[model samples]
Target: MRMHRIGAAMAAFATFAVFTLATAGAALADTAVKFALDWKFEGPSAPYFVAIDKGYYKAEGLDVTVDTGPGSVAGIGRVAAGTYPLGFFDINSLVKFRDQNPDKAVKAVLMVYDRPPFAIVTVARTGIAKPKDLEGRILGAPAPDGAYAQWKAFVKENGIDAAKVTIENVGFPVREPMLANGDVDAITGFSFSSYFNLQLRGVKPEDIKVMLMADYGLVLYGNAIMVNPEFAAANPEVVARFVRATIKGMQDTVKDPDSAIDSVMKRNETADRATELARLKMAIRDNIATPWVMANGFGAVDPARLAASIDQIAVTYEFTNRPKPEDVFTAEYLPAAADRMLK
Candidate 1:
């Protein structure tokens, strides 16, 4: 009877050990990723939250933690400095960074905004109806804003005297408010963001004029998922998984924006759901799901256009060393073409 009881006890211990190992194996399915965004929890950023809420990242074996950033430039710097392995930021700034730091350059993985959202927003009543009108007008922007970063490129190509245009360095939170209160004639901001934000502040849509720099001549690609090349080189599979998961999230967001907005509001309870929803739809229609993105699919760059833009960017930016399209973007880790098409 003693020997039989001892055998039973041994069996129980074996079962418990098996259960513990199995639980740990399940936990090891995905590696955690620290993802930083170019800005706060807002409409344009809602899709990433949707990805998290929808379990797309988990499905791809990525434990992604999405954190909001102060600005696009800051996001780029964070990723480049290795504070975060991945981030969403303005690709143009990456160009500048690559010029300055050749060896430690970050590469854009997923191209979110095919048509750059860089725009100069103004009140129509201010008589700043055209690019030329920006001359002699007080324009506002956060010093590190992506739109402001491209202001030189825009004003240069459009034949505007940038020097004559008075620039007021405003904080991101107060940019639209300052414009609405007549503190500044116009502001450099993302077209989708400042347009709706100004509208919510009682500035009529008709009163607002959004001159997208892309509409004028800036062939620059907008914000994208940037990875520290060192991280990407060491963990190629993780990078691919991250891109694949992001694709799922973006496509899901396109299909049902309301759900994406829900995910966004969850992260930021203070967000005005309706306002952010509207802002999101605008970004989808005008930037994310643009004609080019629709035809060519997402998560890939048009090499010719990228090359042309690099040359065009050189026209405005004095690069310490001119970087090529391949230096800034790569389509290698993009999943099979079918997985990339955004409906």
Candidate 2:
């Protein structure tokens, strides 16, 4: 009886050891990828976290770590420097960055914001109602702000006299406060960001005006997922898997923003649940699910539209050598349209 018991115990131990080794081997097979985001842990960033928490990335044999960035423009540099294999940033900034570097292999892969969130936020008391109202008014704009980068283009498009407007170089933290305290008559930022932030600061909803740049003839795409060309070339499957997982996250976000905010709150402890939820929903309704994206599909851009946007960008930015749309973006890694369409 003792000998039989000993033999059974050894067999059980061997089976357990084999199972543990196989599990560890499978875990080791997963490719580790670090993802960079344009801004802090906020409503719009929830989808990526959702993908991580729900095991969407793991299912694709990827281990992705998402980190917050300083601003939309910073992610461009991060990806180009090979600090992160993938990042979300302003495509317009990426265009200009490529125009200057001409050597960096950073290219936008997924178009997240079909319509740019760039906007000029103001209050009714400021008497700034239209683009022309900005003239002679104090405008608080962060030097590195993605929206402010488009000011030149916006001014040219709307025929606003740029020289007449006094732009104050405010930090991102101070941009909204300056406007709320009446320190500056207007501020340039993302529509959803500035709008909600101002409301949180006691600024009434009816009083604020968000003049979205896209609404004012600035034909531009917003933030997109970018990748280092070398990394992408070496791991095309990994890139494809990353895109697929991200799109799955986006779909979940669009369908139930309320549930999505849970993911953001998990990362951002100080964030107001209601405020972040509102911001996430606004981003989805305004930027992510635009008519074009709804009709065509997500994660891709129209060639003609992208071409027009490039031409519009040239109005403010002088490029030494312009590049074709294909030079900056690719649909090579994107999943099929049927798979990407957000229902």
Q: Model 2, poorest ten-residue lDDT window?
A: 70-79
lDDT, model 2, position 159? 84
Tens-digit per-residue lDDT, 158-263, candidate 2 = 8899999998999988899999999999999999999998997899999999999999998899999999988998999999999999999998888888898998
Q: Model 2 shows how many backbone clashes?
A: 0
lDDT of 1 by residue, 67-186 (tens): 888677766778988889999988888888899889877999899999888899999779887899888889998987778877777887899998899998999899999999999999
Candidate 1: what lDDT?
Answer: 0.87
Question: Among these predicted structures, which one has the highest TM-score?
Answer: 2
**TM-score of structure candidate 2:** 0.91
Give candidate 2 regions above 4 Å deviation.
1-28
